[model samples]
Each structure stands twice: as structure tokens, then as C-alpha cells.
Target: MYDFYKTISKTKIDIVYLGETVCSKRKLLRRDDWLEIAEQLKQSGKEVVLSSMALIEANSELAAVKTLCSNTDFSIEANDMSAVQLLKNKPFITGPSVNIYNPSSLKMLAKLGLKRWVLPIELSKEALSDMQSEKPKGVETEVLVYGRLPLAYSARCFTARSHNLPKDNCQLRCLDDPDGLLLSTQEEQKFLVLNGIQTQSAKTSNLIMDLHELINLNVDVLRISPPSKHTEKIIELFHKTLHKAYSASEANRALQKLMPAGGYCNGYWHGTNGIDWQETTEEILCQLS
Candidate 1:
């Protein structure tokens, strides 16, 4: 984990969200370890935000969120409402899981100390623009430009169930599939991914082709969720594209090679099916015009 963070610190990415945002059972790193890593990343000139789990199902989980919210050094990314309540008026960012779908929700959160909010994965570009226009004075908008979309979360441990084991006694099977265990249809078409309690889109959500639109919408941050492999290269690709070192098409082509077998999707951004990929040629032309 230290080696991974070391590699990330060298990358062009600005913010690094570190924590166990999924199941609490995945105890490879404790709170102290996360804080230590956050400190290291901060020293390395990166803004580190500790992320809380999306589902606070237990007292221990709520306690963890409270502890993270209490940290004074770096900010916290509240993934659940419990975290938000704990972090009230403390100036924090909300992760994609918090469901800030409309301007009213955004306004309310801003009043409660939301400095930035990540657009929910399923929200369209149009929705973002509308919210961006009305978002409170100091609130920044972030978009998930790349990575597998975290579609939903469940209390049940699907990864453990896949192994026919109970949630408590199940071996840490999620560790076996780092990226996520892909689920496919009977026709062999790739579908959703089962990562313990989180359900993610099978296809990686790549929006390199929509960078212009994102910029036009005044997106403050473009998040690239780290995949299991080629993360550094992905960051480099985004940085280059953002700086005009690489054209969007060129970056898109390069990104395709780095992705796994399921291919890519940007349908949610187009206001369509979350698993479908929509071509952005016309949209890019419209934006340029």
C-alpha cells in the first residue's frame, strides 16, 4: 500500500482520497495507517481527503466516520449521511455516494459546510450544468471523469455470497479480485461488478472524449478513480489531455488499451443507460461551435 501511494505521489493528480470506502471488514489498513498515509501524501504536495464508507451499517463503522470527521489536518469526503452529520459545518467534500442530485440538495449541503461535491455517477452533463449555474458561492464541482462507476451499495456482502460463505465468516475474498469480480450475462456480455458490498458498472466509465464539455461546465476537478493497473499512465493521459499535450481522441485511444476486457461507458453522462457507451463526436462539435 505504501508503494502504491509512493507511485501516486509522483503522478500529476492533485487530490488523493484514501480510506476504506467499501466494506468495514476489509481491514488491510486501520485508521492510523490511513492517517499516516494521508500525512505522507500531504507532505508530497497532494491534497489528501480521508473517505468514509458509503454504508455505515454498524456502530464501529459510525465510530470510524466520527473519528475521520474529527481530524483537523486534512479534510474528509463524507460518503454517507452519518458522516455528513458528524462533519456538519466543518468544511468537507461529499463523495459520489452521498446523493447530491439537485441544486437544493447542493445548497443545503453548502450551508452545512460542503466545500465541494462530486457529481453522482448517474447524473447527466445537462444536470451538472444546471446545478453548476446555481451552486453556492464557494462550492466547487467535481466530476468522475474516469473509472468504473460505483452503481450501488448493499448491506449484504455479495463477494462473500459468491464464495458461498456468510458475511462474517467469509475469508477476505475481495482481496482476491483487486479491480472487482466481473459478472457477465448468459450471452457472455459483461455486466455489473461485485466488489463485496458495492456494485459497480462492468465497463470502465471513460470521459476523455467529453473533457471539453466538462471544462465548459466549469468543473473544478476531474476525478480518475485508480484502477488496479496502469493508474499512473491513466493520470498522465488525463494530465496531458487537460494541458493540450494530447488531443481527446488520442487520449481516448490510449485509454482503451489500458482498460480491461469490458470496454468503456459514458452513457450516464449522456442521460442514458449506465452501462452503455455513447459517442461524443456530435457533442464535441456542438461544444466547439
Candidate 2:
């Protein structure tokens, strides 16, 4: 967790999101601890937002979300409607988990004091274009431009089940894999990653090549999910790409070098399967290897 925070700080990320978004069971950092980190980030002259658990199963989790929504030190990124309801009439950011597919939903949230929102992973450029054509007044759009695509959320803890443990008594086994556990098919082919209750793609979907396209679409921010390692490098590549200091080819190469195994994918941006890499070059693969 410190590694993740340090990477963001060193990279000079404009906004840093603290708190666990996947499972509440992973409690290396508590609310107060996260708020303290937020204060440190603010002291460094960066905007900080606290994120709530994506799946709010129990009242305890809901209460934690409420605390995050009510925290005055930083803005809240509402991951669910419960949070949105709590943050109503207060300025907050909408996380990608909140399905704001249409303009009406977005407008409603904007009316409720939503200043920025992250688009869902499945949303293509065409969908973003349609949504932006009627984007609510003063609502900034953010996209999950880089990272492993969070495929689905399940009530049952996949991480616990993998260890043959009951969900109620997970023994905090998820802490064993900081980056998430890799799952494979019967043929032993790597497929998806089990991130507590969330399933993510084995291949990290990147949009360095689509940076220009996203800029054209008027995307306000590009979110890069924290990876296991070299997160600072990924942030640098994204920053350079956004500033036009790095060419598409160069950024793509940098991304390929940063990720492991299955490599860079940008299919969702192209309106296809989220695992497909639209642009590939021999030089990139050589550098990646």
C-alpha cells in the first residue's frame, strides 16, 4: 500500500484516490489512516479523493462509506448509489462502478453535485461520444485509460474460495497477493485474476495509443489503476502521452515494457473485446520481452 501511495506521490498525480475499492476485508489501511494519507497528499499540493468499497454488503461497510462521503478533508468518489445518496447536494466524484451510461443519469448526478465521473470499463469511444454530446453542465468525464479491466463483482469472495475458506472467515487471505491472484483455465492458460470479490482481466488494458482519441473526446482525466510494480513508470508514460511529449508508438512501447505476460490491450476503446490489442509492432514486443 505504501508502494502504491509513494508511486502516485512521486509521479505528481493531480488527484489521488485513497481507500480500498474492492473488498472491505482487505484492511491494511483504515478510514482514519486513509484520511491521514489524504492530508499528506493535500500538503503535497494534490487533490485527494476517498473511495468506498464497490460492493457494500453489510451495515458496517455502509457506515464506512457514509464516513467517507461525509469526510470534509477530501472529496468522495461514490462507488455505489448508497454513497451517491449520502453525497447528494455535496460535491463529489462518481466512481466507474456507478453505471452512468446515459446522459440523463449523468445529468441527474451532476444536479446532485457530481463534479467528475469515471466511465465504466466497457464503455467504448462511441458510447463516450454519445454521452459527451449531452454531458450534464459542469460534469467532467474521466476514463479508466490504463490497468486490468475489472470484469465483474461477486458477493462471494473468490480469494477466500481459492484457499478453500468460507467467506465469513476469509482469514484475510487476500493480503497474501497484493496484486491479486492469477487464475487459469483447465488447459492451464492464464485467464483472469481473482481480486478479492472482483474478477479482473489477466491482461492489463491500456489506452496510451488512444490518448489522442480520448483528448479529442474531451476526457478530463485518465485514471491508471495501481499495478504491482513500476506504477511510477506507468504514470510517467501516461503523463508524457497526455502532454504529447511521447508519440503513440513510444507510449505503447513503454506500456508493453511495464506490464507482464498477456501485454497491452485497447479493444474496448475500439468497440471490441476488452482483451484485444489494436496496435502492435515488432519493436514494442522486442522491448517488452
Measured by TM-score, the strongest candidate is 1
- Residue 95 in model 1: shift from native, Å? 0.6
For model 2, the superposed segments whose C-alpha errors exceed 4 Å read 280-289
How far residue 11's Cα lies from its native spot in candidate 2, in Å, is 1.4
Which residue pairs show collisions in model 2? none
Write model 1 residue lDDT over 1-289, tens digit each, in one string: 9899999999988999998889888998877888899889999899998888899978888887888789889889999899899989779899999999999999999998999999999899999999989999999999999999898899898999999999998799899999888899999999989999999888999999999889989999999888889999999999998999988888988998887769999999999988888886755655694
Per the 3 Å backbone cut-off, how many clashing residue pairs does candidate 2 have?
0
User: Whole-model lDDT for model 2 versus the true structure?
Assistant: 0.83
Q: Backbone collision count in every prediction?
A: 0, 0
Candidate 1 stretches with Cα past 4 Å from truth are 282-289
- The digit string of per-residue lDDT tens for model 2 on 1-289 reads 6555755676757988788898887788866777777887788788888887789989999888877777886788888899999989989898888999888898888988999999888889999999999998788999998888889999989999999999989999988887789988899777899988999998888887667678878999889887778888888888886776877778877776677755667888989988887875546644653
